[model samples]
Target: MIEINLDVVMLKRHISSKELAKRIGITQANLSILKNNKAKGIRFNTLEKICKELNCNPGDIIKRIS
Candidate 1:
């Protein structure tokens, strides 16, 4: 299974969900879905934006569990 650690990274970066979403050009609800690991998938563009804003790599926010 795949898990999203978006909230953790956001906390580390001291970024609020609303701010991140606005900066990344997404809706707060959509960000919540990703943060809560309820998203079916994420676009590369969106992921890039997220990584840029959080100053991290994809591995920093995404995990795979066996």
Candidate 2:
């Protein structure tokens, strides 16, 4: 399954969902979906923006496990 590690990153960075959303130009609702692992999919552009804003690699926020 594909897992999201956003919670970990948020903790490490001390960033709230609202703050991240603002920085990444996304809504807090959408960030909540991603945070709870309820998002069906994500756009690459959005991901890039998040990575850039968060100063983290894609791997830092995602992991694929068997």
Candidate 3:
């Protein structure tokens, strides 16, 4: 399974969901879906924006576990 560690990275960076959403040009509601792991899929462009704003690699936010 793939687990998203977005909350962890957000905490490490001391960023709020609203703030990140604004920076990434996405709505807070959509961001919440992603953060809460309820998202069915994510767009690559959106992922790129997130990585850019959070200054993190995709691997840092998305983890594969067995």
* Best model number under TM-score: 1
- What lDDT does candidate 2 reach at residue 31? 93
Tens-digit lDDT track for model 1 on 8-64? 999999999999999999999999999988899999999999999999999999999
Model 2 per-residue lDDT tens digits across residues 12-56: 888888989999998999999998889998899988988887889
After superposition, the stretches of candidate 3 with alpha carbons farther than 4 Å from their true spots are none
| Residue 63 shift from truth in candidate 2, angstroms | 0.5
Every model's TM-score:
0.97, 0.92, 0.96
| Least well predicted 10-residue stretch by lDDT in candidate 2 | 46-55
State model 1's lDDT. 0.96
> Candidate 1: how large is its RMSD?
0.5
Give the 10-residue window scoring lowest on summed lDDT in candidate 3: 35-44
Q: Extract clashing residue pairs from model 1.
A: none
- Clashing residue pairs in candidate 2, if any? none
lDDT of 3: 0.96
Candidate 3 residue 32 Cα shift, in angstroms, is: 0.6
